[model samples]
Every structure is written in C-alpha cells, then in structure tokens.
Target: MANPNQEIKFTKLFIKNEFVDAVSKKTFPVSNPANEKLVANVAEGDKADVDLAVVAARNAFCRGSVWRNTDPTARGTLLNKLAALVERDSDIIANLIVLENGKTFANAKVEISRFAQILKFYAGFVDKYYGKTIPVDGPIFTYTRKEAIGVVGAILPWNFPVIMLAYKLAPAIAAGCTIIVKAAEQTPLSALYIAALSKEVGFPDGVINVINGFGPTVGHAIVSHLDIRKVAFTGSTDVGRLIMKTAADSNIKKVSLELGGKSPLVIFEDVDIDEAAMVAHNAIFMNHGQVCFAASRHYVHEKIYDEFVKRSAALASMRKVGDPFDADTDQGPQIDEESMKKILHFVDLGKEQGAKLETGGKRIGTEGYFMEPTVFSNVTDDMSIATHEIFGPVQCIIKFKTVDEVIESANRTNYGLMAGVMTKNIDTALTFANAVEAGTVWVNCYSAGAVAAPFGGYKESGIGRELGEEGLSLYLETKTVAIKLPYKN
Candidate 1:
C-alpha cells in the first residue's frame, strides 16, 4: 500500500471558516487513485461536528451582514473576487482534484475553469435580481420581493467535487444565502483548499463551512439538522431518495437533487454515420464516462448499428490511460478501489446477462483503480449496463429502428437526467429534443453547455435545477407586501 501519511496532507477540518480538530478526533485516509495509495489524513467528523457546523451556519444566516439585506453589487463583487482568486489558484485546485479524484490533469484543469466560470455567472446574476409588481384595487398597493433562503446545506459528490460544488454554491451564495457544504469523502482536498480561500476573500467566518467526513455520519447529520433551511445534493438516485425522505421527516427543508443518470444518445438514419460514431465516442469517453449526463446508452439506427458498434469498440480501445498528472493522459483511475469494483461488478453483470462485450473489459493493472475503457454491444434495454448508471468508461449500444422505438428505449430507465441526439435531419432533432424525458438535451454534443443553462434531472433522476436563473431561485423565497396608497384628491 502507498504510504498513507506521505500522500495525504490534510489533518484538520474547515468548519466555520476555520481549520479545527474534529470532536471525534478521528482521521480517515485520503487515497490517491493515481496509484491506489494513501495520500494523507483528513478530519473524520460526525453528528456532533455536524451540529456545530449547522449552528454556526444558522447563526451566520440569521446574524451575518454578508448575506442579510446586503448590497447586491457588493455580493457580486465578492463573488467576482472569489472567482479571480480561483483563477489565480486554478493550477493548485486542479492538481488537488487530480490527486484526490483520479481524473486526467487536462480534464481537471477544464473542470476547474468551468467551476470558475460558474461562479462568475452567478455573480453576474446578483445585480440583475428583480421582483414583481401587482395591480391592486382602490388605494391598496402590493409588490413581491425575492429574498434569500437561509442556511443552505450542499451535499456534493466525489466524481467532480470542485465543479459540482460550484454548481450548488455559486448561485446560493450569490443570492445571499449562508451555506454549510459537505464535501465528498473520496475527494475532499480541493474543497478544503477552497474553504481556506473563501475566508481570505472576506466571507464572514461562518458564512461558509466545509465538513469532510463519511456520508452516513457527517452527511446525514447535515441533512437532518433542523437549522438548515435547504438542502442541495448531487449523487446517486438511491441517496437522493434517502435525502428526500430524511428532509421530509425532519424540517422539510427545501431540497434540490442532481442525481444519477442513464443517459441516452440517439442517432438517426439521416445523420452522417461517421460523424454520429465520433460524437458517440466522445459522449461516452469524456471524463472516463463518470459524468452524470454521460451518454452511456447509445441508440443507433438499425441500418447502421453494426458499423457503429465495430467503430465504437475500435475507438474505445484507442484511448490512452496512465498517470493523472501527465498532460497526455486520456483516462485515469476511478475515484477508488471500491468504485472500480462497482464498475467491474456492473460489467460482469452485463456479461452474465448476455450482453456481448465488444472490447476492453478488465482491470488495467495492479496499481491504482484503473479499468480498461469498455464497450459492450448487443445490449438489451433491460440489461444492467443499459439501465443503470455505471459511472465509468463503459458504453452499452442498443439498436433502434424508428424515432418512437428510440424514445421508448431511452425512457425505459428510472433515470432521465440527460439525452443527446446526433442527427442532420431537423425533424429528428426537434422530435428527440422535444420528446426525450430528460432535464437537458444536447442536439449534437454530449454534456456540452454553459453555466447559463439550468442543469437537473427528470423522473426519479432528481428534483429541482442548478445553474442559471433557476439555480439562483433555489436559494430564494418570494414574498408579497401590501399597503394602502395615499388617495389623490
């Protein structure tokens, strides 16, 4: 095993904007997926720590001037300052993400850049916030006010910790809401690093708190905390459901979940076959297919099904996998051994269920949590790989004849997070985009969008949205005030 003490660095938790020892005094190993070794120690917090953090956030929300009737321009300026700070430290954050999350350095940098842009976008929204005017009868006057929601609890995922954190945090803070963010245990380094800078950027001590610990303990504690007025979570459908149940039973805090996805990529016969094939390749391969909206399920037209599979398998095998720090690295290890094992289990289940594995189906080496870029052909809609969110570099191709058939196959799963359509025909693009049961549909690209676009899931995938104006609204509550206007003589 890699030296746990040498690789991991953090030894404390960031609570109330200060690095402090956990009440439990327990430490967990931060593993580097690059070589499957112990990197450093991070604080192991539990319910007591959660309570303290929640109390701090609640008090801050109720008492701090930073988030209470503060100047919108000032809020925007602070966010911009933080964005600049992030840009200046982008390399540091990128390196931490690569070390702790096991994505290629290039991808990590891009993710960091995206995160920065998201913060900037939310900051831009602060000054443009507006309410509504209502016409009143007689001398009565009424108007609605959009106010910030208090004490937001953001539960983030490990796959893209920094980027996902931006997805939830940027808009909430921009809208003048205090937050207690729970970082994923698998990849908490970048978040802690950012927590440090958040203080440096002049956010009040308790305005932003980060707790690094296990999901069931620290995470559950944050969710169940009575003082938290809202919960924003990004993870699997199972966990999102659990959060919903917990929130309902507790404070019924407003919740927004961006959960799991078994996304589909539909290719129409009218589209250029080769172009569709290449797009499909990128759709499933980018970020090693760990994205929430990875086009894992490919619904190719029956006329070109065989060619697509052969080409996709060839493309999957051509990917480069090596050190995450290397600029040339095309793919890196999964977050950890457990995650690799889960992906492997899914692949094995696919084989057991008679889905033909076309190419690349095994662990790559003894070092790290690397798995071969896998592509499975002849997949039935009901196959585990086609239906479940594998969250790895695995692609399952299914055949379809018509638009209706493709739509049906795409919507078969409980997850409806996103879908992609590659078609030259205008009718096909419009039909797929309109009919697909997903929160976001990419016409020709997969996982392509600006921070201005609202991202979320449909059906059991999740609730609420993130990014753009919708995300901004999640952190706000609307109220109306009425008064009697002076009568004109």
Candidate 2:
C-alpha cells in the first residue's frame, strides 16, 4: 500500500450552496481501500437531511426561480464552466477516487476526463434540444412544449462515483432540472468536493445538493420524496427495484435506472488468439472488474479455446496488483472488506462448482483488501460464478461451438447491458451484433463507448438510456399544445 494522506475538504452535507452537519449529527468513516486505513469521517445524512436537500431542490425548481427561469444557453454556459473546473482539477478528483474507490490512478484520471467530456456533451445539447411541430388535421395548429422535469434525485454507485454522477447530473442540468445527489456510501468525499466545484462555478444556491449516507435512509428519502419529479439511479438491480416501488408508492415520479450487468464477450475462431485474449483480459480486469458493463463472461470458440485460456491465464497472472498510485500497478484493492469477502465467496463457488481455476483465486497480503485477478476455465452457464454479478476481478471463460450456440449462451443470462463480439468475419460480426439482446454491442471492441452514444440495458439489467441525446430526454417532459385557428382565416 502506498501513502494516501491527502487533505480532505467538504465532508459535510452540501445543501443550498453551504456545507453543514447532518441532522442526526452522525458521521461515517471513509477509508482508503488500498491501505484499509481511515481517510475521513464524513457527515452521515439520514431522512431528515434528504428532506432538507429535497426542499432546497424543489425551491430551486419552483416556477420563476433562478434555476427554473434560466435560459437554455445560459445553462449550457454554466455547464461549460463546471466542465472546465472539473478538467482543471482532474488530478485532485482522480486522487480522491483512487483513495476511496481503489481505482488505478491512471484510470481514475481517465474516468475524470470522461466525466468532463460527458458534461460538455450534454452542455452542447442544452439549447439544441427541442420538441417537434406536428402536422394537424383541419384548422388546428399542433406543437409540443419541451420543458424541464423539475427536481431530480440522483442515487450514484461506488464503482465509478464521479463518472456515474456525470451520467445523471450532466443531462439533468442540460434539461434545466435541479438535482439532489445522494453520493454512494463507499465514495462520498469526491461527490462533496464536486458539489463545491459546482457552487464555485456560479450555479444558483439550491440548484445542486449532495449528501452522504447509507442507502436505507438517505437513498430511500430521495427516491420517495414527493416533490422530486424524477429519479436517476446507477446501482444494483435489487436496489433499483426498491427505488421503483418507492417512487410508485410516493408520487409515481419518472425513473431511469442503469443497473447491474453480467455482460458477455465472444471470441470467434478467426481472430488472432493472443490479441483477442488480451482484449478479453482488459475487458474484465479493467477497474478490478467493477464496471457495470464489464465482460465477465468470455465465450471462446472451441477451435481457439486452448490457446485463449493459456494466454488469458498468463496475462492474468502477470497483472500487477498493488498501490493504485504506482505507475506500474495494474489493479487495486476491492472497495471494502465486505465486498472483498463476497468476491472470495464467488471464487470459492467457482471452484466448488467444477470450474477450473487457471491463475488466481486468493487474496494478496492481509493489510489491504487486495485480491489476485482470478481466471476460471471449464465454466458452464449454470454455475453460480457465471450466473451472478460478481463485481470483481474474476473472469470466467466458457467454450462454445457455433455462432448460434454462442448467441444462445450469451442471451441465457438475465443481464443484457452490453455484449462484445470479436471476429474478422463481417458476416459473423453482423449476425452476432444483430442477435445480441444488449443495449450496446461492439463488433471488434469491448467497453469502448462514446459520450454521443446511447447506453443502458435490457431486461433485468435496467430500464432507460443514460447517455447520448436520449439521456437529456430522461430529465425533460413534453407537453402537447394544440391551437384551433380560425377556419381558413
């Protein structure tokens, strides 16, 4: 473990452009996953704190309020200012992420950069988003009014805290909606820091509120708050379901969920075995396999199965797992002990269910929550490791015989967030691309998504899109307007 002694600021709840203690006056300790050491004790918010945030957000979203009456182009300009601030402080944000989320320092920087890009992308759409004019029958003139959907409750995830926050906040701002951000329990400090940045960039008071707390209290409050017009979430499917129920039970607010994924990556017999194997390795191993669209299940054609597994195991074994700040370290620790133990349980399940472990399945030194990049071969579709969403650095490689067979195998799982098909054959690539049930499909790549592309999931994976032009629509409402003109004047 490397030294992570950076000074922490803004550990209190950010509401109405001010930082304050939680209503309950409780605090939770945030620790460095890399070293298993306490970083800061953040203000632990409860339902009361959430209520305060909701009040602030609703006030900001009120008709004739500064936020509600702000021009679309002005909103875009404000977003640009925030994006510039984020870019300028990318290193500091990346440092916080590395200390909290255990993301590799380099990758954390990349994630921060992507967050800026996403902000700018949504910024570009602010003034451009519009409703269409519809042709009407007889003497009627019909059109639609595109308007903001009022206050939004954004419940973020821990894996990529800032990046996922970008997915929700950027679009909400673009649509001229105020937001109450519930930072994930594990990684709250960065969100608070960003909230400060948002205020510093001249956003109106109460336009953006962020709080830190557990999912049961603060998250529930945000989801069930009646005044909030929409809720955007990025987390597990189980919690997403609860949010849906809570929203329905409260005010029937609009919701968009980007949920869990056990995505599949297919390797055809035609591609170069080594290069393809590395791509598969990086797909699963990146971010310690904590990505929602991580290629956890790799399907290799039988012809190249042996070589692929050999190369994959070798690569997994060689992956350097250590301090995230170290330039050479390839992987970091799990977020916490509970997450680490859960991952170990899945590894045990892999071994017990007759799947052969080729490389790693054990924890590293006991100081931190570090684990080896474990690879499993001879995995079947029915195994627990293959069926469950093990958000860790565990890769399960299964053998397949044909295109139809692989496609069926891929679709067998309940998740359909993203899928990858690597092949030189255009026909095979196109077929797999068309057949896959995922929201996003990459023909020759894995996890290479752009800000302009719509991203979400299918089935249990999730309910709505989170990026591209579709993202802005999630925070907006369309009101139909029909005027009957004097008959032919």
- Candidate achieving the largest TM-score: 2
Stretches of candidate 2 off by over 4 Å are 1-3
| Structural similarity to truth (TM-score) of each candidate | 0.96, 0.98
lDDT of 2 by residue, 265-361 (tens): 9999999888899899999999998889999999999999999999999999999999999989999998999989999999999999999999999
Best by lDDT: 2
Q: For model 2, what is the alpha-carbon lDDT of residue 181?
A: 94
Give the Å shift of residue 375 in candidate 2: 0.8
The clash count of every prediction, one per candidate, is 3, 0
Looking at model 1, the pairs that clash are: 7-39, 8-39, 8-40
| Alpha-carbon deviation at 82 in model 2, angstroms | 0.7
Candidate 1 lDDT by residue in tens digits, 1-489: 111232334457877778998998999988888786776788898899888887887777775444575688888887888888988887777878887888887887788788889989988899788788898777777899988888888999988899899998899888888888889988888898888888889887677888889889988888888888899999988998899999999998899999998899998777777788889988888887788889999998888899888989888888888887866778988887777898999999999999999998899889888889999988999888887888999989998888888888888888889999988888889998999899999997776887888889899889998988888999999999988878932
Model 1 residue-pair collision total: 3
